[model samples]
Target chain A: MTKSNEYTDSSRATVNRRSFLKGSGAVAAATALHSPAVEAEPQAAANVVSGATTITLNVNGGDHKVTVEPRTTLLEALRSQLELTGAKPVSSDGSSGASTVLVDGKPVMASTTLAMAVTGKNIETVESLGGEDTDAVPRAFVKHDAQQCGFCTPGFVVAVRALLNKNPDATESQIRQGLNGNICRCGTYNNIIKAALDVVKGGV
Target chain B: MKNFEYAAPCSENEVLQLLSDQSGQTELLAGGTDLVGLMKKMIVTPDRVVNIMEVPTLKNIEAVDGGGVAIGATVTLDEILAHPYLEDYPAITDAILGINSMQLQSQGTLGGEILQRPRCWFYRNGQELLDTGQISGGDNRFHAIFGNNGRSKFVQSSRIAPALCVLAAEARVIGPSDSDIQMIPLLDLFRTPRQEGQREHTLLPNQLVTHLVLPPVNGGLNATYEVRQGAGPEFPLASAAVSLELDNQQRVHQARVVLGQVAPTPWSSAAAADALMGQPLDAQAAETAGLAAVEEATPLSHNGYKVQLAQVAVKRAILRAAGLETGGL
Candidate 1:
C-alpha cells in the first residue's frame, strides 16, 4: 500500500481502498456561526495569515487533512492533495463547469471556490457518485453515449445527480438549464440531453 | 495564481483593522467566485486575501422596519431567489435568472456581483482597461455600443446593477474603523474610470460593502429583459430594466428606465422614462420609449447590432413591467 503522506493515484485507490486513512465524518459543526470557536488574537490580527495552514476539508463524506495556502483552490485540494482526480480542471474561468462539486448539496464550481473558504462544509464530489459498478446516472450516460472525449463525463454525472437530488421530478427543460454549466466541447450535447432526459423520466 | 496569506477574521473590527494594516494590496474574498478567476489570470494579484465568508453578521437576510428588505452582502444569488419577497421584485428576480449558470448562482454573492470588472475580450486577454484601439479594430461585437468612445469601451458586466438601480437600492458601506459607516445610492457606487489608478467603482482600498437596503416597491411594477445569443451560460449583449407606477387615470406616473451590459455603468435612461410619463401603456408608447433610450447610444465599429437589441430590450422590459405581452422571444 502506498504511504499516506505520498500521492496515491486514484486508479490504484480502489485496489487499496482499505489502506485509506481518512473517512467522512460529522466532525465539522456550524463553524460559521456568531461566536467563532477559533478567535483571532488581538496582536496577530493584522498579519494572521503568514504562510500555509493545515485545515480539515470534508470531501465526499471523508475528512482529509491537507496543508494549503490561500491560493489553493478546492479543485486542487481534491485532485492534487487527496488524489480524487474525478473533477477535471478544463477551464479556470469555471464556465466549463468541469470542476463542479456540491457544497452543502448546492452545486458550486470547485475551481472558483478557495480551499480556505470551504473549511467546514460538507463537500460532495464526483468520486462520491457510486462505486465501480456505476449508478443509474452513469448507466444512462453509457446507454445514451452522452460523452465524446469523456473529459466532461464525470462532471456531467455529478451535476445531474445534484440536479435530481434537488428536484426529483425535474422537467426536460429544467434538466437542460440545470446542467448548462457543464459543457461538452466535442458537441455531445444531444446524447447528454437524451441521457439527462432519460434519468428525469426515472428510466435507467 | 500567486501564493498569498489567508485570514478569516472573526469580527468586523478585525476585518477593518486588517484591511487598514495590510501594507500591500489586500483583496477581500467574500464569495471567491469572481476574485479567484481574476487572481488565476493575474488580473488582480493581491498580497493578502481576507476571507470574509465566515463573518457572521454579513450572512443575515432580514426585512427592515419598513416594507423594504436589507439583504446582507455575502448572501448568495440562490439565497436571494429563495427569499419570501422575491415574487414582489420581478425585476431583481429576472436579472438574477438571466445568470443561467447554477454554479455561478449558487456561489456568487450580491456584493461581488455589483463590483464585477468589465468582461471585455481585449481587457481580459492581457491588455490595459482603456485599450480602445484593439476594441475598435478587433473582434468587437461584444463591446459596448451605448457608452463607447475612443477611451474605455468595455461594458459593465453586472446583470444585477440595472435592476438595483431601477429599484433605487441603497448600499451600506463600512471599513477602516468600526465607527466608519455610510449609506449611498447603489447607482452612485459605479463610475467610468478615467485614470491609471482609478477603479470602475468609487470605493477606496479599505472600504467594504456590508449590505444593501432594497426599498419597498410600494405598488410599483418593475421587470427586466435581456437580449441573448443563446440559452446556455452566456452574457447578455443588451438588457433593460424598467420600474414604473400608474396614476389613478391609468397613466404612467413615475418611471425609471436603466439599460445594462451596454455601457460602463448602468445607463439610466431618463429620456425613456420621460417618454412614458403621462402616457398610456401601449405598443406605440413602448416603441417611443425604446427609441428614446437609444438616442444617445453611439455604437462602436462592430457593435451597431447592439443598438437594435438594446432598443428591443427596453421596449420588452417596459411592456413586461406593465404585465403586457412583450411580443418578444
Candidate 2:
C-alpha cells in the first residue's frame, strides 16, 4: 500500500471509486492530466467583456447581445452586464428566490443558471413583467406593503406574476406553495400571500 | 472567488476530452445552483469549470426500453415534476415537489441536485482540520460539537437523494474516456467521513454524473415525509422516503426504506425493509420498521432528537405510502 502522504500513479486509477484510499497510480495520473492545462494557458481576466462568448437572449420582447463567461450565471449577466437591476441579488444562493427570473416561461433562479445555457430560450425578468403601460404585480405589492427593505420585492413580484400567468385562478394554497421559494426576511409573508390572492381572485 | 477558465462543450466526446486533459483542476458545472454558491464561498476553488449544458445528448429525458425512465444529467427538476410519465411515480414527484421553491426547481438540474455537496456547518464555514498555524486560539466549539464520524462534518443537502435511494435509481457516470461509462448504484453514492478527514463519496474533480435511470414502479406505493425546523428555507432535520411493492395477496414483496439528514449519506436500512417484507403493511408493521431503521444511529450531542424524529418520520412515511392514516396510533 502506498503511504497517504506520497503521490503515486496508482492513486489516479481508483479515482472513480468513492473511497479516499489514494494509491500511487491514481494520484500521478490525476496530477499529470490536470497540471499541464494550467501551465499551458494564461489565466483569463475576470469580468472582462472582451473575448467572452456572445449569446442572443430575448429578454421581455427585445433581443440583447450579452458577452459573458461560460461560468457567468444568468443572474449576474442580467444585473452586471445588462444593467437590469430589477432582479436583486438578495440571496447569493438559489434558495432565497431573490434572484428569480423566467426562462422559457418558467420561473428559475438566475444565480443558479449559466447565461450560455439559456441561449435560444425566452428569458424574462422583472423588467419584462409589466408592459410599457402599467405593471399589475408591482402595484399590488406596493398597495399591500409588500416592500420591506425593497430588496426582495422584485423577485416576489416576478414570481407572483409568473404564478398568476400560469394559473390565473390559483387557490390560496397553490399560491403559497408557488411563492414558497421567495423568502421575506422582514416577516411580510402574510401580506405577500394576500397580495397574490388579491390578484388571483381579481379583487385588485 | 478565485478566477478559473470556463468552457462549454457541445458533445459528450468533447466533454470527455476536456475532462481527460484537465482532470483534477477541472470541475463540471451542470446547473450552478449549488456549485456557484460553493465557489463564491471559496469552498471549492477549481482552475477550470467545464459547463455541460451545451451537450445535447446529456439533456434528454427518454423512456427506457425496459419500461423504466432514462433521465439525462441535464434534466431540470422542473421537467421531472412536470413529466407526464412521472405522475405514476408519485413518490419521486412528491419529493421533487417538496423541494417546492420554483427558483431552485427551475435552475437546479436533477443531476446537480443529486451530486450537491453536503451542508455540514463545519464544512460550509471552512474549518480546517489541519492546524495551519493561522489560528493561535483553540476555539473548537462549532468544529467539535456537531462534527460526526470525527472528520469533516458536512451534512448532505439534497432532499431528493433519499427519495431516489428508496426508488433504487441507477446513476450513470461519464469519465475521462469514451469507454469510461460506469453505472453506480445510488446506494453507494455517499460515504461517512473518516475520524480525521473529509467525507468520502464527494464527486471527484473529473467525473460527470451524466444520467439517472429510475426503475418503473409497477405496483409499489411510495411516499416521502420531511420535518423542517422553524419553516424558513433550510435543510430538513429528518426526512424519510419509503416505497413498498405489494403482491396480489396484499403482502409486501419488496420494500426500500431510506432516511435522510441522519447520516453522512441517505441512510438505507435493510433492517427496516426486512421488517416489512413478507408481512402486510398494516400499522404494526410500519411501526416496527420505523423503530428498526434507526437502531444503529450514533447521534451527536445536540442531534439526539434526530433519532426519535427520524423514527417517527420513517413510520409516518411508511404509513402515508401505505395509504393508512395513523389517526389514533
Per-candidate TM-scores read 0.90, 0.83
lDDT of 1: 0.80
Native contacts conserved, per model: 0.51, 0.32
Q: Which candidate leads the pack in lDDT?
A: 1
Per-candidate DockQ versus the true complex?
Answer: 0.22, 0.18
Candidate 2 chain B — worst ten consecutive residues by lDDT sum?
B138-147
Per-chain TM-score of chain A in candidate 1 equals 0.75
lDDT of 2 by residue, A8-116 (tens): 2342232322211111234323422222222222333222121377888888777999987765778888988788988878766677788888888888888767777
Residue B95 error, candidate 2, Å: 1.3
- Specify the CAPRI tier of model 1: incorrect
Tens digits of lDDT, candidate 2, B1-329: 66677777665556666663433466778878788887777877777777788766567655543456657788888888877657656777867777777777777788888778766555566855333332223332222112254444445567888888888887876655544556678888776656444434645546667677777787689998876664445667788899899998899999999887776567788989999999998989989998998887766545567777788888988988988846532
Question: For residue B137, what is the lDDT in candidate 2?
Answer: 34
Instruction: Calculate the i-RMS of every candidate, to one decimal place.
Output: 16.2, 12.4
